[model samples]
Target: MAHRKWIVWIRRAILLVLLGALVYHSTIVIQIIRFRTINPRMTALMRQRAREARARGQVPKRLQVWLPYERFSPHLVRAVLAGEDPRFFVHHGFDWDQIREAIQENLEEGEIVRGASTITQQLAKNLFLSTSRNPVRKLHEAVITVELEMLLGKRRILELYLNVIEWGDGIYGAEAAARHYFGRSAAQLTPEQAAFLAAIIPNPRETYNPARHPARVERRRRIIQRRMRHVLIPAPFRAASAKAAESAFAP
Candidate 1:
């Protein structure tokens, strides 16, 4: 009788959990629909960081400017794709090859030494999730990424990512990063400048200023620049490349 009672309770708990998950996911789907056209003013990650800063008795100010996709330099776009997600244009959301490799490396190292987050996955995490490394959080990120890819086109996804990703302690977006680092607009960034920005993205908080770690940043920047020459920019962004080139020459 006790065994049957325990089994009943377990079934009840599972149903409740499934119901909760369904409700939560429905809300996320609604939000994704809204974001298809509207630019987000702030993201969950940014708000979480702000709350932590306030708890520590420090004020956090985010420096960000929203620029249309055409306003950004082509070199910056290509360099970022080269450094972070070479398969961004090709993959649906996840990179299976990278995922398999990362899984093997993590098993051997007994810890996560590598990540296989595609640009879409990274954007999903930045927009809607916390920085917690847990199975639940990763699942949520994956779900949101699929929703983003389905609701918005590739160009919009890349634009949202560039405008919301952290570039420094307080700097957000390509425009802010360009002005903060190179004293130029995102449209005006040189190939070298763009490559340097892309190199520090993986550790933006620590390597915010490329000048501070010239050797490390330079090495990564060179690698990205070399890759940029051959890496394919998605077709949607190709038209902007000519505009980006013109802006690079602007006085």
Candidate 2:
């Protein structure tokens, strides 16, 4: 009986492997047919969340509004890259150097001193997965990050990330965040406002308040300005951005 049970378990394992392979191949074929679409896993999750919200008789609070890359100001994009992911243009989906440094910092501090996610990895997590922190979910994020980067170039990746990332509880995208926070379109957002908006993305739901967190907003704005001066964006754009930033923060 023990021998028969062992053989049965082995057979089940083989069947599971075959099923996994079939699904994997099907996924590849589907992806080939939909190269420009959001990752399938993300679309499914979005639908599931919407369906669950409807089942609970709750309106889904998510607000996603995709815009073309051309709609956003190049300065705003540069500010986001400078603030969030400086190596976005050069790195692949993963930045192992930053990951290693983050791990070391966390170990040394006994707290999360740094984030290990690259822009692509963050985009995958924001679009497809929840805020749950676990090895299994992180592995899935990494896999999907690679797929997204393979299918979309850096420009498209940044554009989609800017458009879909949650800025406040019910606000999403650069356009929405700008309107919600500053009463302006993303194209008209002054550099200080744009920098403050970028600062909030790390913890959008908690960190910012247009009324209450003035000090924190000023500090983050300064950091963004300093970094903006050092890198990203062209020199003329930088000068104009600096001027706008100074004007925005002027009492």
Candidate 3:
């Protein structure tokens, strides 16, 4: 009788532990789904209001504003695409070639100078993580990246990235970045201005100061212009894009 009771207790304990784990996993899944599918417009509006409040030296109501893709210029999108991931449209959530190359580079340098994270991976990190660099955080980032890719399509993922990308210390999204960097709307960003913003994505905190880093900005702008000159868009749109970028880093 004693042996049977002990066995029963052990089984019950095992079952309880399994149930607890199931519940925890279910909660995390629910949160991920909600985060991925929540109305983006509402989030954008809230962020915009918060940005305004912060600019006015009032209490910030939110962390960041995320502008929808429509509010951004095609040049902005193209510049980001060219600079970050030229094969963005072709990959699912991970790019094997880039991953392999980054691995090789890391091994050769004995450092982590290159990361092969796709746009989806970047979104997963931006939306869900703090600035902790740990194995646990990296594992979670990968899991969440897969989950988000499963939940959101490529277009939706890109949309989220465009809106959520941190442009400056407090600036978020292309619209805010364009206004803060160039004194214009996102839709008005030209290829050069867009390229300047794109160049800063690698290290936004250190790379994107217009007044203080005029030389660096000019160099990046020239590079972006040179790279994008051959790319084609509509004539009128191209003219407007060129206009916005013409005096992008001008004092």
* Each model's total of backbone clashes: 0, 0, 0
- The reply for model 1, stretches above 4 Å from the true place, is 100-115, 207-212, 243-251
In model 1, the Cα lDDT at residue 142 comes to 88
lDDT of 2 by residue, 21-106 (tens): 56864674466337466523334335555676789899976665566666675557767876677677778888777778668865
Compute the lDDT of residue 194 as modeled in candidate 3.
Answer: 82
Q: Which pairs of residues clash in candidate 1, taking residues 3 or more apart in a chain or in different chains?
A: none
lDDT of the candidates, in the order given: 0.82, 0.68, 0.66
- Using lDDT, give the best candidate's number: 1
- What tens digits encode model 3's per-residue C-alpha lDDT throughout 63-98? 345565555676786677655655677777788987
lDDT of 3 at 199: 67
Instruction: Evaluate residue 38 in candidate 1 and report its C-alpha lDDT on the 0 to 100 scale.
Output: 91
Candidates sorted on TM-score, descending? 1, 2, 3
Superposition error at 219 for model 3 (Å):
4.2
